[model samples]
Target: MAEEVEARTLSRVAWRFIPFLILCYFVAYLDRVNVGFAKLTMDTDLGLSDTAFGFGAGVFFLAYFLFEVPSNIIMDKVGARRWIARIMLSWGIVSGSMAFIPEIASAIGLSAEHTFYLLRVLLGFAEAGFFPGIIFFLTLWFPASHRARIVGYFMAAIPLSSAIGSPVSAALLGLDGAWGFRGWRWLFIVEAFPSIVLGFVTFFYLTDRPADATWLDPQARAWLQRRLALEDRRREHVSPSSALASLADHRVLALSLVYFGAVACNYGISFWLPTIIKGFGLSIAMTGWVNAVPYVVGFFGMIWWGLRSDREGERTMHLAIALALAAIGVGGSAFLADPTTKMIALTIGAFGVFASLPIFWTLPTAFLAGSAVAPGIAAINSIGNLSGYFGPFVIGWIKDATGGFLWGLVTIAACAVVALAITLALGHDPHLERAPEAAE
Candidate 1:
């Protein structure tokens, strides 16, 4: 009876929540990273240099970094429904407007580069709290035993977007002569609409907590609430008394650096991989197909790895192993002059980098709770994502100065290794989550 109840409730919750959230994030990530696909033609259309484009792409993170913690804190105070709707609506407007930078620049008397930089930054601020907000929201519902796989499922949207959205983005690029606009213009406008529609959907469709989840059966809802409540009480025993103290917690600080390193490698690859593929003499359409390969493989790897971590009830070792794999794959690619070998190495690196992400969140979410967990999650994510700013900018600078991506690739790999070491040194607290027996 207990097993049946557990299975039924969890399955219902997963179906009720995960798929819709996945679609929302799918559109969110598509808007954010689609810039990579756009750059193929956008750079030429706007007369921008690689360095300038990198700065424009990466400047989004700076705004994201500045607003993330505050925005998340606000979400915690207000509710995910309102804040997320506002974020989506605003960013969709900004993202769609990206297609109009030239006209906007002419109207405002600013250079196109300056206009591009402003729009990217605004888009970042608009989208700031959404990711960490979702992660924190997951903790509110899922038990520690279930979290990694849940997060794995949610975070899978990242690569899945690239895998599926890349081809669509490529197709949009072919719309160059249609509607008196460039392909990148159509790409941004079409992609931006889903987010706006979804913002309204989020406002109406999402319920804030289990008590409010009217769609669930009464018995299943009660069971889920009990399980989640038990987990939260367990967490409160270790969580700091106030949310403010979490801002300075040593573990939070350490995790921030660890995330910084891993994210540095992840975004470095994401923002540049299209260009890297283009360098290999593939046509633009072919680059999209090739770029999707690593991510398609990555989609399966992320789920399997997260499940392994959950089943074993081990966070640190799993994270360390993934980060180490990332280091090896990405760095090793730097030395391979042969196109096939280099692609193979990068594919391996992408699998690892993508896999590490979902498992990494399980650690902090395991121990922190009540008022503190909100700020702790925000701080870690906001600080950690600063690496996003550095990663692309440095790669672009190195590519410009050295006339190659070799050193840039090496640098990103080294960051992943550092993240691995940090994970090992600050291994997870066993009692903070489910016991091994419970996992079994």
Candidate 2:
């Protein structure tokens, strides 16, 4: 039937963009979290104290928060092809420069710790625009009804990146004397170059919008454009002024709080998990290998939750459930005496944390539409990233003061509870009146 063929055709087009987005996010996540692996060795090699290392790690979020909204707005105006390519290339260069920090510091007669700090800050600035820009780009390509699952698929890159990066980082770290550089330094150098190549590839392969996609046949293009227009009309008209006005809405404020709480708990666990496991008496290589397990579990969890959300056309309940699971996991890990119990708790905790990500991203795009959607999503994301700064600092400070991870894990659990409270308060419905012109 012609109808069936059209359905299949649309499905192919819808999914075509996903793989590229996944690759982009995979590299971004790897670049962001690679520091975790680097820290295991770099701390001693660079003479950084626990506090100093935490500060350096936390500083990335400060830069990320500062530029997130501006970057999203720019992506809206300049389009994804140029902006994303620029972001990838710039950050790749900065990421690779991380390899030379020690040598540069020695050459300049600065302390290794100070140089490391400086490099981290620079890396943060370079990577500031990436995640939010990707979110903004997604709005341009996918319809609202379909955004959550696509976002989930794209977000799966997070765990997948971790899955691949864990073993790769372990191998790199073991390459201590390969080419006159420590394994940690080589990790930065080798991991960062791929993004640069991908950046150039993106410029050629990615189209900013359906209107700009020249590869589609005339019938296909016409069909897609019509669908998009109808979908847009389902939503209420958000004038440019009204788009900005959404910032003043009470719901937006509440959602921001929920986002902050969620991100705090997520980053807190991400930055500290390996260290916590190592504290349980595992060797560095063993810890790295073990780290992949949670990420693998998390990948499956994210897929299951994402598919469920798409099928049910729901968001809040799943997010609340995920947060509740995370709270229990963190709380149990903090209190349970058995090592096996703690590891089980951590695996469940990662599953919960990752599972919530797609839902968290879906809410903002669902609530805010049109020109306002980009800024609204960016604002939520920017505020949410502040948790990145707070989470790491809180965990590090608690660990330094308490001489263990218990208080820190408890603090993260408390944050998860706050996230749950906010989610319940926000309710489940998508608030925006769908623009009729939007693509279904």
Candidate with the greatest TM-score versus the true structure: 1
* Predicted candidate 1 versus true structure: per-residue lDDT over 78-177, tens digit per residue: 9888888898899899999999999999999999899999999999999999999999888877778888899999999988999998889888998998
lDDT agreement with native, every candidate? 0.89, 0.79
> Which pairs clash inside model 1?
none
**Model 2, 259-294: lDDT tens per residue?**
787777777877777787777698878888888888
- Number of the top lDDT candidate: 1
Candidate 1: segments with Cα more than 4 A from true spot? 435-440
> Model 2's lDDT to the true fold?
0.79
Estimated TM-score per prediction? 0.97, 0.93
TM-score computed on alpha carbons, candidate 2: 0.93
Q: Clash totals for all models, in order?
A: 0, 22
